[model samples]
Target: MSEQVIAAIDGSEFSEGVCDYAAWASLALNAPLCFVHVLDNHSAAPSEQDLSGNLHFGAREHLMEELSALDEQRAKVNREQGKLMLEAAQKRTKAKDISDSTTRQLNGTLVETLVALEKDIRLLVVGKRGETAHQASGHLGANLERVVREMHRPILMVPATFKRPEKVLIAFDGSKTARKGVEMLARSPLFAGSECHVLIVGAETAENHSQLDWALDNLREAGHQAEGAIRAGDVDEALQAYVQEHGIDLLVMGAYGHSRIRHLLVGSTTTAMLRGSHIPVLILR
Candidate 1:
């Protein structure tokens, strides 16, 4: 069966880049590409006011008028721009031999629409930061982490300048976090024929190295062809270099690599990877 790839396009440059990445993946996997643009009604709506106390001035009426005009303008642009984005993305992936293409303009909270569509989506490609996100926040889009936490499916976050992926890098640490990622690989026919490189970092002890090897052995047993290496360095740096050197298209790794609380306090290897790595990342928590 073919995979279903969903690209959440918000008419922002970052989101448009996400569509590009999604189209590339759809082409690579011979899957269908679904472009979704959610019109956020909640954000566009006006907040409730106390009519009992505010009967003196026409502030509420004025605010309502302004909000109505804004909503009208936003809705109009969303439909036209959304259709154009989907059409352009379709044209970009002409080589995919796509079975079909789908475009949706959903009206509701962005997360709600995406969650509702999650069951049928195999891969969800999103922008690292949306139009509203600031550069100095030291993170991705505000809703990005939330979606990753809530969505049952894997999310591939594409940076604004991301090029087409050439290879995939897998970061394994033999933990349940990593186990979830392995499970994704096990069930995913999308990656069956793709090239995968596995990296196991911080195997100081002989026993530790043995466990890493066992994980690689399990992957090989699962019918995936992977080349692996044990590296001695900071896990994030090693993975970053591997990605850069191999021209990796995607970096797959476990979220909260180790010591969740410590990670929360001082950030984790995955956080570092997000901050440093230029390629798209597939994070499994």
Candidate 2:
């Protein structure tokens, strides 16, 4: 089977957007699209239960049986709900002209399920927030952050709404990690036709200028219509400003890189760009 662009949907408000973006990637890469909905099995542990054995023998057995039945019932409902979500995701992809897309309904933690299928994944698409997440929380759903950190394949983390991208931004910081992002874009057809911008948020030092020139040259050589600039400000502030002023539809970056740009993914202001920006993020490993 061909490597698949997998979109992890969970019937959340962001599910539709995930489908749309995944469809775009599937078409661009000429890969199969698979919609996956994993049943999150994060239930209360046995340790958290009332296991004091304070009741009579028959009462203890009855309580254990009741709990088991309840758990079974909940899993049953989740299975049916996941099936419907997969079907809806398939419909959405079909409407995008991806008639041959597939879906999988799995019972396990999302992270482990995706990791097991890692060998077959060309790209993974997921929503920033999950069904249980609240918009007012102002934080990324825990699963999203963990997946980005652990998954080996490139990931496309989408927002609650999506628009076909017209412009793309690379949050380059002259780090090896950031350079890897440039290489990923140059090799993939996903951003082949979109206008690309390489923005370095810092002083326009001679070294910074050299780094920008190197990026532009590499992208140009790879047949991408790319340009570069060095702006002065904090990494978070400058990036946010440039995105708004330039109408960037997608933001690309390398995770675990160096400096403030690096901090944007793993530092105190981890969500500075991923959560702050209104566009989808393409995180290259």
Candidate 3:
């Protein structure tokens, strides 16, 4: 019953990177890895259309039966495709020296499946852009935003390519979720040897400084080489600028907070950061 890193694969160009990143996570965290490919039934369902305009009642019934058979056949084909995708992902993970891995093909939405498996999931690894998103071009994955919002576990979103991160940035805002994120970095092996930077956006208040100091102390005490700084201006812009300026390979942050509420009300800095970030994002709950 050990916690597992669940990597969602869609057989896209991003799938290989997802597997690679998940393998790194599994090694770092000493956790088992599971590859999950969801065969989205809703998306695969055949559209209903009326074709009785030129048919008798009996003929219409026959057509309906044929359509039903076609739908069944399509579902079967999709299931086989999903299985092949999972097998390929498993092979890739095993090649990364992660032999203690498993693969599953579920029949539902990806977010829903992850939520159902939340308790056993140590971390969820997914692609920044899924198969559909990649095809659409410039659009974020349909499930990325929703998964971050709905799941209560950590999610590691891998970009198109995988790079072993050497520097890590934690976006701290003094929120409970942010504090939890700090605790995770201190306790987990995920960022073990990476140079850690804690950045707080906005005017430097005593409270904010104190919080950053406390976080840095915690990380330093945990054997992490940690540093802290305060930046002024827009949160997302400041974050993006800092990453660009500092050569950050990974960005860690709480996925939602008052910022998420703002996203609901107006726009979300969290969403913007996710959309605009050039590196992989480790989103804590």
Candidate 1 local Cα displacement, residue 22, angstroms = 1.9
What tens digits encode model 2's per-residue C-alpha lDDT throughout 175-278? 87778788777777898777788999888799999999988888888887887689997777888888888888998877644567656676643566777667
Per-model TM-score on C-alpha atoms:
0.76, 0.91, 0.91
Q: Please list all clashing residue pairs in model 3, or write none if there are none.
A: none
lDDT of 3 by residue, 1-285 (tens): 778999999967889889999999999988999999988856756677887787876998898899888888888988898898888888878778888789888888887888999998999999988777777545666578778778888889888788999899988887776787888888778888888999988687999899999899989999898987998987777888889989999988775567532352124323567776668988777
Superposed Cα deviation of residue 230, candidate 2 (Å): 1.3
lDDT of 1 by residue, 126-172 (tens): 88766566454456654775676668777888877757544667787
lDDT of each: 0.69, 0.82, 0.82
- Output the worst ten-in-a-row residue range by lDDT, candidate 2: 41-50
Which portions of model 2 show Cα errors greater than 4 Å?
44-47, 51-57, 135-137
Error of 3 at 129 (Å): 2.3
Task: Tell me the lDDT of candidate 1.
Answer: 0.69
